[model samples]
Target: MSVDLSGAHWFKSTRSAAGNDCVEIAHLDGGRVGVRDSKNPHGGALVFTPLEWDAFLSVARGGEFDRP
Candidate 1:
């Protein structure tokens, strides 16, 4: 679960507006993904397995996380 993010090439969604508040993501080795707060790059990251990341993207694209 401890993925080294030192060389991570973090980037935010292109759909995101030009602002400071956002989350950054990096595609890691072995198909894993890394996510971290843009405001705190050195804080830490949440690593997700390929399957888990894919499932999350599916729900996200389906608006499952949309506010009611």
Candidate 2:
């Protein structure tokens, strides 16, 4: 299903530095989520379903992306 992201209210992590090189997230309708780069707000976003977002968060919290 295609989501209308024209009005997405994107926000980034508060911990992000002032350099503007961070990822932004927006809560879309129908329990969907959108992610994009702060450097280019109009560059489009990667959409994710609610379940996929949950699974991603779970793995992220588990240090899956941490350096070995």
Candidate 3:
């Protein structure tokens, strides 16, 4: 699925500090979402469907990707 992200309004997590190492997220059409590096806005992004995003969030909330 191709999502036109030309009008995407990307935002980063509030927990992110004043560093270039951050990811930006944007809500796309058809309940999709876009993720990209904040320091590289012009770069490509990883688009996720609603279901995929939800699953990822669930795992994230469970600390699956936490660095211990």
Candidate 4:
């Protein structure tokens, strides 16, 4: 299911790097999630299902994608 994020409330990561090097997320319509870059809000947004977003966050919190 697709959702429009033209008026979503975008929020940046509180732990983001100093130079705005982080992604932003918004609660989109239809119970979906919207993600984009804080550095380029106008670039575009990618929508994800709630389950998908939760799974992604789980791995992310475990440092699965952390760059050492």
Candidate 5:
């Protein structure tokens, strides 16, 4: 389902460095989540369902994205 990310409070990762080259995310309605680049707040955002977010985070924390 689509969600309106506008006005949604976006935050950068606490692990990010001084330079803001990271992405931001915000929770949305309808069990959805919004994600966008911090450098481009007005840019388009990608929406993901709650389940999708959970699965993505799980994989991320499991070192699925770790370089070999």
Candidate 6:
């Protein structure tokens, strides 16, 4: 699925530090989500479908990615 992100209003998490180093996210049309690196706006991005995004959020909230 090709999702256009040219006009995406990307934003970082509020927990992010006040700097250029962070991840940015944009809620796109069709319940899609966009993600990219703040330090490289022009760099490539990852687009997630609604289901994928939800599953990711579930895992995240479950702390599946917590540091050991």
**Candidate 5 ranges with C-alpha deviation above 4 Å:** none
> Pairing residues by index, what is the TM-score of model 6?
0.94
Report the candidate with higher TM-score, 4 versus 5: 5
> For candidate 6, lDDT tens digit of each residue in 47-68?
9999999999999999999999
lDDT of 5 by residue, 1-68 (tens): 55666679998889999887999889887768889988888988999989999999999999999999
Quantify all predictions' global Cα lDDT against the true fold: 0.92, 0.92, 0.94, 0.85, 0.87, 0.95
Tell me how candidate 6 scores on lDDT: 0.95
Q: How many residue-pair clashes does candidate 6 contain? A: 0
Q: Predict model 5's lDDT versus the native.
A: 0.87
Please provide, for model 2 over 1-68, each residue's C-alpha lDDT reduced to its tens digit, 9 standing for 90 to 100.
67899988989889988888999999999889999998898887899999999999999999999999
Residue 3 displacement in candidate 6 (angstroms)? 1.5
Measured by TM-score, the strongest candidate is 6
Model 6 residue pairs with clashes: none
Poorest lDDT segment (10 consecutive residues) of candidate 3? 1-10
Cα error of candidate 1 at position 34, Å: 0.3
TM-score of 4: 0.77
Off by over 4 Å in 1: none
After TM-score superposition, what is the CA distance of residue 63 in candidate 3 from its true location, in Å?
1.5
List RMSD in Å for every model shown.
0.9, 0.9, 1.1, 2.0, 1.2, 0.7
My TM-score estimates for the predictions, one after another, are: 0.91, 0.93, 0.91, 0.77, 0.89, 0.94
Task: Write down the TM-score for model 3.
Answer: 0.91
lDDT of 4 by residue, 1-68 (tens): 55667779998777877787788889976678998988788987888988998999899999999999
